[model samples]
Target: MPTPGFPPSTLDAGGGPIWISELASDDPNHAVHVVRDLEPADALEALGAKPRLFRPCELPRSKPDKWTSLPAAALGIEPGEVPPG
Candidate 1:
């Protein structure tokens, strides 16, 4: 049985939730495999790949006297990543 606010799971041989097996087969698109929580530059160096970090929602809001300018990179998400109507 799954607890409220948690994902479903199966019973292990010893009757515990089978978390390890589930993690081993985790969805590639949803999983984040990191040796450590590294900063953007450090993470790129360690993984030899660019690292993407989500910005805080409040960070994008316009200030009291200023207009907001959204970055093109923020609008470069894949079409499939957008929510369906």
Candidate 2:
């Protein structure tokens, strides 16, 4: 079964710690996962919603979003430094 906007990677057995990801979404660089598991009206409720039915975060923003902003320089390696064998 194909989930509308959610990717297959979000599918899990359910009933445990909640997790959200957008690595498999289209335009993943701009994609994000929002987990809303509580309803303000009823704090005790489980939101009674399905994650697969949730929409993918596609808001327009500046270039190089968090997911695609990982640079090698952040690893404390010099520009021309190669990995030790």
Candidate 3:
């Protein structure tokens, strides 16, 4: 059963509310890895970025790597493998 304030299992097997952010990774072959319970400042440090403007929004939970790679795919860049989170 799905919990209140959480995404359904069909959308996200983890069955938790999904969050969106501007994530950054040092490794080109891997997804950005940041602890879920990070403070906003900590998250910014992880991205090696200074404060920037962003509007928070939510979307249906889905395999993000698939869609996030669309632009690369259009440019004929092979999609990288995304390990199960």
Candidate 4:
């Protein structure tokens, strides 16, 4: 029951979205964006090959790579050690 040309895919019931990323830290000054595949078919088609029988550690949900909050100065609150101007 396998297709000849198209890659194989299955319905994953207990996994998270699969992201494609390099194993490198993103530059602080120049940030990078990551894309994830939510559908198994899309992932398999992109890969052009079938995945392993049992995938391990399907990766936990991602957290913010960097702090996106406004700077302390913008918040009108300065640090304790710094002199108040």
lDDT of 1: 0.39
How would you encode candidate 2's per-residue C-alpha lDDT over 1-85 as one tens digit per residue? Answer: 4343455554544422123222233243453334455443343235454544443234232324433322222343345567342
**Model 1 vs truth, CA RMSD:** 13.4
Spell out the clash pairs found in candidate 4: none
Query: Residues 7-63, candidate 3, lDDT per residue (tens digit)?
Result: 453333354333322112212454644455778667866788555532233433333
Summing lDDT over every window of 10 consecutive residues in candidate 1, give the lowest-scoring window.
64-73
* Model 3: lowest-lDDT 10 consecutive positions: 18-27
Off by over 4 Å in 3: 1-30, 61-85
- For candidate 3, list the clashing residue pairs, or say none: none
Q: Pick the candidate with the highest TM-score.
A: 3
Query: TM-score of model 3 relative to the true fold?
Result: 0.29
Per-residue alpha-carbon lDDT of model 1 for 1-85, expressed as tens digits? 5442324445555444454334334422344444445675676557565344433232222222212122222343343364222
Q: What TM-score against the true fold does each predicted structure earn?
A: 0.24, 0.18, 0.29, 0.21
